[model samples]
Target: MGNALRFLYGQCCSEPPTTTTTYGGAGDQQLGHHGVSSTSVGVSALAQHLYHFEITSQVPEGLSKHVSSSKKAQSNWYKKLSKAWRESKPPPKTPEEASRLVIRTLQRHQRPDIEVDARAVADGDTVTVYVSTSDAPESSRVPQEVHMAAVERNEARAHKNYTKADALQKQIKDAGYGVLHINNEEILARKYRIRLRGIDAPESAMPYGKEAKDELVKIIDGKCLKILIFDEDQYGRFVGDIYCNGIFVQELMLKKGLAWHYTAYDKRPELEKWEKSARAKRIGLWASSNPEMPWEWRKNRREHR
Candidate 1:
């Protein structure tokens, strides 16, 4: 099953879009490249076999006709399909119903996007998440065997069966999954460190730094975040925008004056607007006549050291 999903994901990536998106902002912005095309991944036979409908570019009727052959289009389709699949309670009763659902979902998202789950916050602008094998839209469901293995490993450790536990751990790692513990609950997940895009907050020792961290924790703690990854930084942290319950996390921080818009790396007009609003109101760090930038603080600390 793992191999099959990998093969299908490769099929999604094998073809590039006819056109690439250009970012006029600062630094290099890496948008959604990790995407899957539902139309090409064995969807035709499923539609035909189950719905008695032939989905092809030649025939071009129903869902097939509307979907673009481009990779970007397919990626967007998959993101919508993923959201729909999660929201669908009774699931689709028939192939026609499923096809209709796909059509509806495809209409909403026109841009490329990537997604991940947040597990912990390092500060106001950095977080840790787990990206397991199931993060892919093609394989939204985690393999049952992996879950069982995790449970078994825990039992083995409890029983002092170190050898057995080690073997099971190896199996889990080989399958691209890791064992995680959150509030004493054992979880199977992968670790991903992410840096919030377009904003830089104060360091821990800086003014309002603790407040900034606390506010971030308050907003995201125990809540699943929808992260749109843009790029990866030198420290191996993914840089992205975080959305919690449809609220833009970065916007809140900037508007509250907890963070500064890192204009050198990001040129989002909204980020600049939010920061300006906070500054005008003298909120958070903006209350200081001359707040030291986190970058500058880090530089001074380095020089002193």
Candidate 2:
């Protein structure tokens, strides 16, 4: 049971969602009028690793094939759920449908050799699961191979052996999973912070910075978020695509000119369309005569310090 959980913690957090929607009514509401910046000042107060992925490897050849097959089935279920969310839209009905979809996924996952125990955690909405071998009465609750793999993986991470960590990360990803946390470090579901991929907004102190965050808060504060991490930035933040209730938040940010397309890192050439539109419309940050990019601004701040 423990081994399977460790593996899951490493491989499952979220996936990129499809389509997009906007919470347009937000502008009328006076949320955080004092407009204190949260992304850097108050936010940087809490320390975080720039990047991390969690998962265990080392399943044997025969069993690994089975596991991979199971993962494909799981992925299909998740994709369908995402599609439904986008098609049906968010709200009173969406939540019920989403929950039922999850149950359906679990039911579909039933297998004779595995007993899947899943329950809601006290911390928040995330549901954790335990997978035990039920092939034989004498079998260990946590498969022996998975347990040993986790042990080795943890030892490598403890020694700062990132080479092993990277290899293990690749193994986990290839096997169709994403690690949400490592070693039980984050005790709360809210600690699962995801950064917007393909773009970076100005710091809180910078021009329009507060506006960007305010827009984000309006859009995602209560919406279900899906993140697909492609890589991690130097700051240790997971660099990934963010979907808020099936809407592509990054694209919206660009549409509003609330963020700069982080070309050096993500290189989303298509984002130029939204950026051009925002510039023509003189929206948000583009309202400034000559606004500084967040990357250059951060560099200047560091050099001055």
Error of 1 at 115 (Å): 12
Per-residue lDDT tens digits of candidate 2, residues 260-300?
88787766677877888999999998998899988898898
lDDT of each: 0.62, 0.45
Model 2 scores a TM of 0.41
lDDT (C-alpha) at residue 217 in model 1: 84
**Which window of ten consecutive residues has the lowest lDDT sum in model 2?**
45-54
Each prediction's TM-score against the native?
0.54, 0.41
Runs of candidate 2 with Cα error greater than 4 angstroms are: 1-190
Residue-by-residue lDDT tens digits, candidate 1, 71-159: 22234344455557446665443445455556566545322222233336677788876653322452355566676676578668768
**Model 2 lDDT, residue 230, Cα:** 85
